[model samples]
Target: MDSVSPWLVILGMAVVTVSTRLIGYWVLGRYQLSSRTQSILEAVPASVLTAIIAPMVLATGLAETLAAIATLLIAWRLPTVVAIVCGVVVVVLMRNVF
Candidate 1:
């Protein structure tokens, strides 16, 4: 079996990552996007976030999901760093005791 050196692996990953970003930027810059396309692009971040969070929330069930929702609300209404800390604390406490 062949094993890759750690540096080689890291170098390969960096190359691939940069290439992907350059390709995306090149493609996007070449196009004159429609207003509808721009609107859709605006939703991309939220959609990607939802795609990531949805499955984890569903698998954890109602209590955890509710805790996360509350955390996000608190995070939104308060200072971002403080809100994140509070959310982490809540989730950890819930998991340990419940």
Candidate 2:
């Protein structure tokens, strides 16, 4: 048994990531996707977002949940900087007062 340096582990992961992406591009370029497949691919972003956020809302405390909602609301329509500042404010106030 041998211990590997952390840099080697990180380099290995980078290589794997790049290799897979290149392979995916090479393979996918050979095919033409139908409308149905394109539609499914378009839906993937929303589904992935839900998959990521569903558990965060379910598993966290009320303050965190409220913060997430606040963040989303401001982020949905406002500038990114405004949303971030307002979200931080909302979370801070919620945590302090709740």
In lDDT terms, which candidate is top?
Answer: 2
- Which candidate comes out best when scored by TM-score? 1
The 10 consecutive residues of candidate 2 with the worst lDDT sum are 55-64
47-79 per-residue lDDT for model 2 (tens digits): 989899787665766776888888889889999
Task: Go through the candidates in order and give each one's C-alpha lDDT.
Answer: 0.82, 0.83
Off by over 4 Å in 1: 1-5, 61-63
TM-score on alpha carbons, each prediction: 0.75, 0.69
Provide the global lDDT of candidate 1 against the true structure: 0.82
Write model 1 residue lDDT over 4-51, tens digit each, in one string. 798998999999999998997798889999999899999999998989
- Model 1 deviation from native, Cα RMSD in Å: 2.5
